[model samples]
Target: MTEVDLHMHTTASDGMNRPSENVRMALEAGLSAIAITDHDTVAGYVEAAQAGQTLGITVVPGVEISTVAEGQDIHILGYYIDVNDERLLERLRQLRSTRENRNAMLLERLRELGLDITIEEVIEQAGKSASGDETIGRPHIASVLVSKGYVASVHEAFDRYLGKGGAAYVNPPRVSPFEAVDWIHEAGGAAVVAHPGLYQADELVERIVRHGADGIEAFHSDHTPEDESRYAEMAARLQVLVTAGSDFHGERNGHELHAPIGSRRIGAHVLEQLKARAK
Candidate 1:
């Protein structure tokens, strides 16, 4: 079992579990530490960190930022971030605004495609998934599609409508990798390119490293054995830190609760190095 899971989510973003529940799940899974890296927001970290203090589990303050490179979306994970940084908060507020605007457009597109879902329906579904505190995301809309029987599952909804190339999809404004790394550093955090394999942009890694990324997510739920080896070699050759995580999202988006939380083993020392970079 993994003693440390550096990446996870909570109701503050798209994950099903609330911050406290995610903390309890991490403890129940026997993790010594975990990071709540919610998408585009740090709203959950305070609650998770507080719960960790009470339960004796370490909670690392983090966020998963969505950035675009070469017309494709990639994620950057920031560990030990100063969640209260004004500049960071400003950027996040803009991102949330972009998402909200995109959601409205997506709803219009879905309506044109003859789906019976509405924004009110999506909000209701998102509330059902969380404590009505989540950043409204495409997954919430997809869940509404599923509940309304317009789609068989969230995956189907995405495959047919919500995914990047789907008819209902709309591109949102995104910062470049360079900007993302700079933002994380400005917020007093270590920036790591998340799930590099998923990007299929091998050439992009060296470019990100050039932008001063502090680490590589060598082990992730989506990484293949080959990806692990390649990223390990890249991290070694570049002399960058290596980190691992389950990318646990509770039961949201077809993710199982326990399979990932305790699956990938991330050494405590990796986090130590990340914290050092944060300082």
Candidate 2:
């Protein structure tokens, strides 16, 4: 009955917790294993792995790469990555550069719309580090809006301002999910399409799985029972692995986003399924 939540975030990306704190939280929740799937960076993995070693909780080296296709934001999860692959580092650096530009554009758009906000505010809210390279994303912006009462919740903030088609939403050029799949493989990792239900595009999800993705996240904190059943069936038909994750981004204003760490999990066996399927 051992379980693993293959997707979680930390301060390395947009999540509120630090890498060691995430591991300690996972241990408290009694998870047998977990992954630190930060966006566009593996900066948190080493800390998480060291903490996990001390706590006897298995840590999977992972990252959540930001990709775009068909004018929509998509995430591809990489598991068991080398964490020091030069190719992965070069590509992620490029993606983070694009993100920096887009964040500026988005903030300007919000300001034009008369919302008083700054990238510094967003970075401070994201828990800035000495390196100052933490990945600042829409979720961090959404939190600032929530704190300022411009939005009621992060979900609403996205719906009204930060998400796709929201007033200040700006998508810059980035890698496609297809390219990300190969990036994961080249980094000696397995790529899983992260949370297909959010996309509302099953055809594209199917294409990616068919296009050599190791799996799809069939179970997620945001997914309904139907989403789980549908994607699970799709994976079965396609004869690929099925994975689950909480997509936890830590709590804000006493609200735990995408649920808590162990809210959505699958048996530990799927990690094996992933390793076997990857290139």
Candidate 3:
């Protein structure tokens, strides 16, 4: 089947690869299409789209908007987005500001936990991969932890300090999933609930669908077979689109942070299904 991985990241957010590099990687992976779903930014998608055009691969314009509901972090993925939409850009700027506040609070908490880390170190680590408008985030913090020998790897860093419920984990105020769905709709994109299995809140996921999410990411790199089955069932029951993605965040010290591009894929025609909703 012609394949597409609908969720991915690049250095424009937290992934280690550059945006254009991701497009090249997609072509190498034999993918017919992929989305540049960087956290809260479309610059990666814009860059990848250009590169994909040159490389003859389909790059879907997308962004991953972080949201919160029921004290859990949820991400709403937007496909076929208007990258230049002024309102979307302004909202993203606000979200980035909120992320800054979150970072400060997280840093203070980590310091209190006796870690010898700083914002400069995080910025330096992020700059190693980032180029233009990249959003520095917890992954960079994990990189700092690994570099300082505080953790052996990014996954270990998250397991010990950075992930939800870890000693240093902090969640600041952020927008709701409902609001994110509205934002995607206003920007003329199909909104998909990202990695619902990670959230572990069936009621909250159901509520987001009821609130008008256009799709659910049923297949993801981190999801178990049970998770995929459950969400696919839910999507079918709700009459919403079921999507698949690798959630590809490049590598750290040669180990994949998430999954390789095309690791979890769906038919390329699913891209048209999403675009149809977007239209």
Candidate 4:
């Protein structure tokens, strides 16, 4: 089988594995292609692509942009993006600044609530656990909380405190869905909605298709078999490509690194469509 996994993360963001490590894992898992779809950053793609070449694996350049629709967080995935596009890099830098500020505010809120965690503590925790040059995210913060016995798990930490509308929830600045798709196009990539059923309403899928999404993440670890079929049907009706991935985040997610790699299979025709769009 020609295995292709279009969604994954690395230490460049919150994932436990580095780009090189992820590539190695994918190779071991018998994947033919993989993308390092780091959150808001393409910093790891070059390294991942290089490593993939060394291992005779195809590394598709990708990024996952955080967006909001109807007050819910949505993720958009870009495949075959030009990682060197200056405009994309500049926007991502701005987003990173917003994330840093938000993290600082969340730390302060936790401190005010007598959580006894400091920015320095959080940074230390992140540094200790980071896989490579990955930037620290809330998962790192939650890891710190869990280590200190403040939360039982990352999910609990997010649900009770750091998640949207939670106690320490602070909305970060984001690109609109259209803007995200445009930026991906500017970077010479095809944009797809990642895991649509996670939080979006059924109608929102059609809205996204109208907004320039070229594909849908139909096969995902988070999707049930029924949901997968639903998304596939939607993609067919909309004349959009259907992609698949594991959404791997490594050990931080309590799942095996690269678990189900290539299990979510995208058809060769869909890959061709994505490549054509990227061109």
Candidate 5:
């Protein structure tokens, strides 16, 4: 009943809804606050914040940065960032460029596999969903595949060909975890390790904590009840705040949007600590 969802996505990075539409959805869902944590892009935050204000919902400026550690992709979430931060924007622009180049290579690989999809088609599908300067992502490509009947589902598309080590997987350049934490801190936000349970490693949690992660996404859509409990305990032991959200990417991910508002609420005290650090 706290009415806060700190993790979500929009057309800025693979989510189906535009920023305004996502804000409307949050309002309709009775959410008091929501964060547009788009992958590698904050392009949706300004519009989302404006729309949230119009709807009387609080919007948290956020970003999900992709990082690599020990050869696996890890994501870090930054909340309460200054959306207009020039250095942050520059870094995000570089990341977006990397994503575009990686997607192009993936598309080429898919074509080589005899799939008739093209970068233009993917961009066209994304344009239908995006507002302003939002960038497209692999989820957008998966949607195109689904619509074309080339794949039955987004998960299927990823598992069959786009996920790490999959046929079309193209590794994008990643910033070091330390650098990611440093930037998020510099941008006046709290950095959290996303979905620790999915990593299935306690050592990774330790490594991230050592690297300046202030919190852990203890409750997530992909975490089981036991997993959640385990992470909550781990966070407490490590003296880090525990946060939660649905990681909602919208309709393309069937049954995902149902992760209700405040489904796994974080403490206001934790948010306060984050705010203090950001200041």
Candidate 6:
């Protein structure tokens, strides 16, 4: 049985590990392949691929795009993406810039609620939790809150201020689900709905399929046995490919679902299927 983890992160986004380190970890864990599905950016693929080449482990060029569906956050994972696709790169650049503005707005809201943390503080916290190069996100801010004792845990920080309906919650700018799938296709990748278990809607799987999802993430670190069964059934019914991954973001205090690479046994055939779909 081959092992592959098709969902992972690096310092390019919120994960603590660098792309090279992620590859090294994969090799150490005896993974046959791993994907660098960093949030919204394929910037880490180059380093990961280089490391994979040296280590003889397959590195799948991938990205996880955050989108919105019926006001809920939806993540779409793209496998075998052309990392140099101009359209994808430009859109990711815009998203990163917008996220910076959103972080500022969130901080202002925190101030309104009497939390006097600065952006610098959040950056410092992220620096401690990141690989020296990363796009600052709410996790970094939540880490800052945790370090300051403003929240007992990252989950607490989110519940109190960052989560939806929290006092400091700021709506992020995101593309639509259809747009996300189309962009992944435009980049010559197979678009799969990521971690269907994370969404509250019971019909999200079918909805994503309707939006042209080529596959579904049937196995994820956050997914329970029941969730996996449900997603597996949905993928079968929808006649789409099934994928699995640990969604490794490296070890962090608040980052749940932190598993070593290849913790989920993704069949090698799944990789072959994704590659077949790749242009």
lDDT of 1 by residue, 1-279 (tens): 336888888878778888999889888888889989888899999999899999998999999988887878888999989999999988987777777788899999999999977778887777744233347888788888877789887778888999877889887768888898999999999999998988889889778987799999899888899999999999999989888888887675463532457577686777779988874
lDDT of 1 at 198: 84
Report the C-alpha lDDT of model 2 over 1-279, residue by residue, as the tens digit.
Answer: 999999999989888899999899899988999999999999888999999999999999999999999989899999988889998988888888888899899999999999999988887787784244468888888889999989889889888998888988899888899999999999999999999999999999999988889888999988889999999999899987889999999987666778799988899998888778666
Q: How accurate is candidate 4 locally (lDDT)?
A: 0.81
Cα lDDT tens digits for candidate 6, 236-271: 988889899888877667566357777776877899
Whichever of 1 and 5 has more lDDT, that candidate is: 1
User: What TM-score against the true fold does each predicted structure earn?
Assistant: 0.93, 0.96, 0.97, 0.91, 0.91, 0.93
- After superposing candidate 5 on the true structure, give the runs of residues whose Cα lies further than 4 Å from its correct spot: 128-133, 253-262, 267-269
Runs in model 1 lying further than 4 Å from the true structure: 128-134, 253-259
Collision pairs in model 4: 11-134
- In order, candidate lDDTs are 0.83, 0.89, 0.89, 0.81, 0.80, 0.84
User: Which ranges of candidate 4 are over 4 A from the true structure?
Assistant: 128-134, 253-260
Scored by Cα lDDT, where does model 3 land?
Answer: 0.89
lDDT of 4 by residue, 1-279 (tens): 467788988878877777998899888877888889988888888889899989998888899987777777788899988888898888887766666787888988887777777767777766543233345678888888888888888888888788886788777656677788888988899999999878658798778877889999989988989999999999999998889999888775353533455666664456678989784
